[model samples]
Target: MLTNGLEKRTLSDVDVRDAFFDELYRLAVEDRNVIFMTADMGAFSLERFKRDFPKQYFNVGVAEQNMVSVAAGLALAGKKVFIYSIVPFVTLRCLEQIKIDLCGMNLPVTVVGIGAGVMYGGDGPTHHALHDIAVMRALPGMTIYNPSDALLTQASVRLAYEQAGPVYIRLEKGCLPVLYEDAGGGFQQGFTQLRAGKDISIMATGLMVHHAVTAKDILSRVGLSVGIFDIYRLKPLNEQALLEVMIHSPRVVSLEENSRIGGLGTALSELCADAGCRVPLMRMAWPDGHCREACGREEIHRHYRMDARSVAERILDWVRNT
Candidate 1:
């Protein structure tokens, strides 16, 4: 939703890109050392940065690898740099640059990648960022953020700028409803419990958070008040706290748009193993493969049996038949 001063706006009114730049612009205003550079990606609020804060805006054409290297140099020069690009381009394409230039020195450069998961569902697998989380989490000292709403995106900007290491912010496009009333100090914990339930808990991140909340309501019709945990911060997850939440439920499901291999599911799985928790865990994520069929996210989700209905039905079967 479009934010006007402090007045609350509906969730549908804010675009992730616009909310991001809007918040970063505020930071740039206060700190002239803050800069934004991109690899010729989409221009949501870029024009504003160019027109009003020209000195802090940079457009590095289509050379993504070079852009990361440049941002590393800027960081070395005592500047807080943010490189905006599509998911694959910013991380996968320039993995070496990010690893050697930014991560090598633990620079304070924030890489903002748009189109989290299948946000560009119609754009085919080439645009899908199914492996982005796994790729990013592997970078040494890199912090990953997958925001579920505009409020978190704004908070993420501040957190990324304030932190000392390289940070990656994953975002989804389109009109997503607001999931947070306000992002306060607790955001630093890296996760939030949306609701509590006795039977099962759906630990979701990014856009799937909406599906989790909807699935919670859907399950309620069948007399199940499912728990919800939004794990926005992927890496450096608060494992002990998350385990505390999971131990209360008989089953826990890690929900996300990325692949189950090395995404949220895998992370949670590792946590359970290390903590010696025996609660049953299920992974709800994009199937490990590519789809050529051009479609919207909901349609693709339905085709893959990953929609809200599927999520509810699956949990229903687990709760009733298991």
Candidate 2:
């Protein structure tokens, strides 16, 4: 079955991690100045990097803070450094180092965070990165990029390497559905509207983009035209594009896997208020507290009411009430 004329795919069907690793390896091969560092994770992937460029790969066992600092040091010495680790361990655990060492120095270091936003669903709260966006977005000069699928993840890796500054990219453990067949649709450092509509606008980021697209389809089938925007860059938000969309639709909904506070919803709300555009705004996200148990990704998603069905029902209810 298809929702909103958009078909669904799973990570097992796509090769996101491999695609990202391949791109990283390609860059390392060409540029001797490129270095890969992982905090005891990504053994198989780092093995490939070490096999090709042994001198350029470093496995700093379980030291995310030290890893970020070391990457910043290397970047200062004119080296393109990429640090890879699990989301919570790398982003939250090393927040101070990321801010002080990387962002403070304005170094070109790419910190790749895996298991973003409960991708490691069965791993429990310690592993889930529900607040990485809010934490990373608060850091000055840090570019936060969240790719919806493997293709965009690869493109984001390439862009992070080329962009000058501290870049934080959130990646899943494996492949996700290919939202865009090619990156030629302009996956810039801002939000991009994936589908256009006239009734409501759905702003989403990370894995939620897939669900947002699904929700769009569900609404469209009921004769409700909805627009969907993939928020790739969260920190330096594309204010103009977001405002234009809000103005066009007048009703807006933001869907994210992270907490409602200080996430896409918060950012969009602020943007709308600043632009003096008042419309019906809704947010579908995790509540302010932490989840207690370790469960499957889909189970957790349903528990938080973040699935496509819940999103569609909520939007439809909102439309009906409004």
Give all candidates' CA lDDT scores. Answer: 0.87, 0.84
Rate residue 129 of model 1 by lDDT: 91
Query: Would you give me the overall lDDT of model 2?
Result: 0.84
Weakest 10 consecutive residues, lDDT, candidate 2?
Answer: 2-11
Model 1 agreement with the true structure over 1-322: per-residue lDDT tens digits = 3343323656458776677778888898899999999898866666777788888988899999999999999999999999988898888999999999999999999999998988788998988899999888888999999998878887889889998999999977666788777665648999998888888999999988989988999999889978899999998898889989877778998899998779999999988998898899989887778865699878888887788889888878877776
Cα deviation in Å at residue 156, candidate 2?
0.4
TM-scores of the models, in the given order?
Answer: 0.96, 0.93
Global Cα RMSD, each model: 1.8, 4.3
Best by lDDT: 1
